[model samples]
Target: MWVLTQKINEREDKNFSRKCLLCRLQFKGCRADYLSHLSRLHNMQLGQPENLVFIDDLLNCIETRLESLHCLFCNKLFKNQTVLKEHMRKKQHKKINPKDTEFDKFYIINYLEMGKNWRQVKNEPDDDDDDDELSNAENSDRRVSVGNWSDWEEDEDKVENPVVCLFCERSSSFDEIQSHMNNAHGFDFTRISVDMDFYHQVKLVNYVRRQVYMGHCPYCDKILPNRRELLEHMSMESHFIVPQMQLWDQPEYFFPTYENDSFLCHLNDHQDDMAELHLSKKMEEDCHIGSC
Candidate 1:
């Protein structure tokens, strides 16, 4: 769980004074403990700690945002320090925005994979799963499976993350992100989600992520320099919404930022119904799994 806070070849110690901007706590802490604190308290996580680098810069940028009265998750502004603290505390927005490109450098997967970014890695089918596809054995049990539920059920409760906003840093329980997005952001999810299957929903989200990261308005195509300005333009024009279905449904957004992004799991309302069918289906069929 050791996070690389400094460049790889740096001579200075990596485990220097690390700060938790969300919690307003400072500690001369080891990188591992700090990462654990972030995961446990904030539902904020990057890739495996070993695959990360220059984590300190990533954190410092977040800290600077907080000090300047910006909402860490959504980059929304507040009137003053007290209101900003209350907004985050009440909304539980302690996590990082997975869509934000500011974090892409810290993750090694983006660099390791030639054509794909780290976020896309999870969406692509794993090579190991392509086993014995053409095994035309005499006994071909179409109902055959490779693994069981027990493997995933181990510590299932601990694995479930606090509900995080798909579009913001807010982390809450009892599905508060839904209400926040619908009410505060005017996201007509129920209205449009009917047209989207689970995978379509994921792509749509990633499409929004891409739009925000690229400073393009998903609704209008107007470009801004940063997320804050883009949001301001969108909010000013009431553009917090989906564009035409064809525009968002692209192959690129198929890969999500977090493999087990709990927010993504919540996208499919019919998860229970889908689970039973998935278990009984053939092992060679398309494999799509997400956990938090």
Candidate 2:
């Protein structure tokens, strides 16, 4: 009977500790202080706050709310422009996501085999023009005869920019093309290509071919199921507009500046720091339990 009573009292004490001390109208303390006050004053056993589920969600919410923020992907917290630039080099946001597309692949393969030497000057094929000379030459080459080039040439004028990316070969405007190169193929466009054949051939091709790409918006980090959804995201205010300048330019590659004001620069750093600490504490607790 004594043991049963003791057990019941213990459960009651635990439940009392779990209630939010500052949650009531009478008390208006923050979560940490209220929890601490309850444990210390009422001799209550502390447990996790009911509202917070995963630490990531809590941290993310807190992080967005703060005034000065850090890059979530990079550890660099930005109070100013100088700090942000330092972060970009160290964090290398360009490297994290390779924006490879199907069109990039076609462009790269075709560019490697056939240089950008030919231009289709005429829209109409002249019946009197010499098809026999080109056909005979093509027929002589054993490997080149594999695919129908004439059929490809007929439709080629419809497509702009045949220079296929090793990752995607779609005809994107020049501004968007570099992003495809960096994100999908893992080619740092700024770096000088040491081995032209290797860059166009083995290294770049192997980089993206090995991995399965689910296309994501570079600005919002939203992974869409299809290209249509990605296009919709690109048009919306939430997504970063691809700058008119070359993608390799520091302004385009680093800070996503649609306007003079920056959203990332004005993030909540303190809240993010606090949330990270809280998460670290929880992880430590979990690890301890697991190890034991």
Candidate 3:
């Protein structure tokens, strides 16, 4: 009986290490340590059923982790049940039992292969007109119009210089004004993209400025005189507009203008930091691939 128990312990020890479903990190430890690692890294809670579906290829000895926490309606993967529920609520993902097997196969497989091919081509030397040809085709087919500069001329004329902040009634450079707005008033213009037309962009900036200056809560329709008081009221009442920028249609037209110059500068810095972090992580996980 003691010899049988020893054999069972040896078998369990050999298969002790398991790969995390989310981050794909192979962990070798006791159950408590593994659970702690999962909780710390992936924010996975105990007693929560992680519906991970695994398929093994016996010929190749390869195990593939199939995505199970995905919305069939949207075809989007979620981190967990809480996030999935939030996404379902926001996107209104409803059940549509349409026969989409063929469509799904073509879209999922062919599209992924096409994307991989495109990435490979993109990484190669600039020796062909493939990119230009694709860009021209896309531009020719796109119907979205970014409004002309003439349409926003009237509003531009209202301020002495294009860089003046109407909220604080301060005249400064575009960069300074943007920094001031972001730091002091919580006006995150970084969220605004270059896809927005001059008219809408100007309107959005002016609207937020007006709201902050007037101490008017658009949600609750309350007017307060004090700035501090208004901020408190807004925090308590959750009165704020979520700015949504349209997708970039014309990549060539999207340049760093005086309006978005500061935001773009910050964005570049942020992207650089992310790239460095990603490189470091890749280096750390270089030898740990396919250990499961």
Q: Estimate each model's TM-score.
A: 0.38, 0.17, 0.25
Q: Where is model 1 more than 4 Å wrong at Cα?
A: 1-160, 269-292
User: What's the lDDT for all of these models?
Assistant: 0.64, 0.36, 0.43
By the TM-score metric, which is better: model 1 or model 3?
1
Highest-lDDT candidate: 1
Better model by lDDT: candidate 1 vs candidate 3: 1
lDDT by residue (1-292, candidate 1, tens digit) is 2333344432245556755644435766566567665654445554455666776776787778877779887789964555665565445466567787776777766776677886788787657854636565523543243345565566443424676565556676525777888887788675677655656777787787667667799898899988678778888999988888888888877666555455554454334324434644533243434321
Worst 10 residues of 3 by lDDT: 51-60
User: Model 2 residue 66 lDDT?
Assistant: 26
Q: Candidate order by lDDT, highest to lowest?
A: 1, 3, 2
Write down the TM-score for model 3: 0.25
TM-score of model number 2: 0.17
- Native-to-model Cα distance after best TM-score fit, residue 215 in candidate 2, in Å: 47
Is candidate 2 or 3 superior in lDDT?
A: 3
Model 3 stretches astray by more than 4 angstroms: 1-162, 169-171, 218-220, 235-292
Please give, for residues 1-292, the per-residue lDDT of candidate 3 as tens digits.
4434433453345345666533335767544455444343333333211211111111011122113546544567765433543453334342211343322221122233444533354466676767545575577555333345565666543433335543455555555776776666565565542444333443444445555556765345478888768777766655544333332233332332234322221112233334545765775577577463
